[model samples]
Target: MTDSGEKESAESMLAEIEKKITDAFEIFDHEANKTVDVREIGTIVRSLGCCPSEGELHDMLAEIEEEEPTGYIRFEKFLPMMTHVLMERRYKPSPEDQLLRAFEVLDQDKKGCLSQEEITKYMTEEGEPFTQEEMDEFLSAAVDPDRGVVLYKDYVSLMAIEET
Candidate 1:
């Protein structure tokens, strides 16, 4: 494609993405007043599959002040906040439920933990098996060596803390 053609393509794609973000925002703007309750902002963003960390959400919220005493975010503020997030490819963490469900599948015994051997087998034999070094790095933080197991729920919580 020509340079001009590629530029147009990029512009159109951005326009389409903005349109979708507007549509999602409108879902919460039930009154059609171009604003939505401040509290619903996080839910709306998450519903659109954006996984912004809590700090990022706070920053976004800080950028937009509510116009009324009741607290709301005007669509004008929401659009660009969401646009930058999407365009920059930010906020891609998997939801907690997803992480838990994946661990649940591997914890066949439903004991809320996985043995070291089980973790090693899955991490080494499963999809995109980790290299010995990678596995070592992963396990160093993911396991409780004294207990010889990983309480996945605790580990996931720990990861969530560190991720932000």
Candidate 2:
């Protein structure tokens, strides 16, 4: 494509992205105040199909606010932050981080480990529940035989090893 064509394509892509962000803002700005609070920000990020860790979400919010006082983020300000997150998602993928976050969600008690019962509950609630055999296999691979729990570190290491 020519330089002009490339520039036009870039502009079009940006416009489309902006439109999607605007639509999301409208959907999540529940109060119709044209702004989203910190809690709503998490919902918005998840609504976009991104599962950022709690720390990541906090960091993102901090980066968005800078030194400003805690308050709602106007759509105008949120747009750039959302764009940056999307860029980071594209350039620096972190499946490990996502997995850890998922584990954390399952480890509801903040126990640093998931017991067989916990895994079963989560998988069952996830809508195509795991079969008994699949559940047993997953538990065997993920859980520590001695502790009978899937520690966070073990889970992360196992997932990383599998990736390679």
Q: Report, for every candidate in turn, its global Cα lDDT versus the true structure.
A: 0.82, 0.73
Cα shift from native, residue 74, model 2 (Å): 1.5
Model 2 CA deviation exceeding 4 Å by range: 66-70, 90-116, 120-164
TM-score of each: 0.57, 0.54
Model 1, global lDDT: 0.82
Report the error of model 1 at residue 90, Å.
0.7
lDDT of 2: 0.73
Using lDDT as the measure, the top candidate is: 1
User: What TM-score, to 2 decimals, does candidate 1 have?
Assistant: 0.57
Task: For residues 1-164, write the lDDT of model 2, one tens digit per residue.
Answer: 56898889978977877787789889978899878776688768765556566567778788776366667878877898787676555323346777788888777789899878778888767766666866887787888888987787667855542221
State residue 79's C-alpha deviation in candidate 1, in Å: 0.6
- Model 1, poorest ten-residue lDDT window? 155-164
Find the candidate with the highest TM-score and give its number.
Answer: 1
Candidate 1: clashing pairs of residues = none
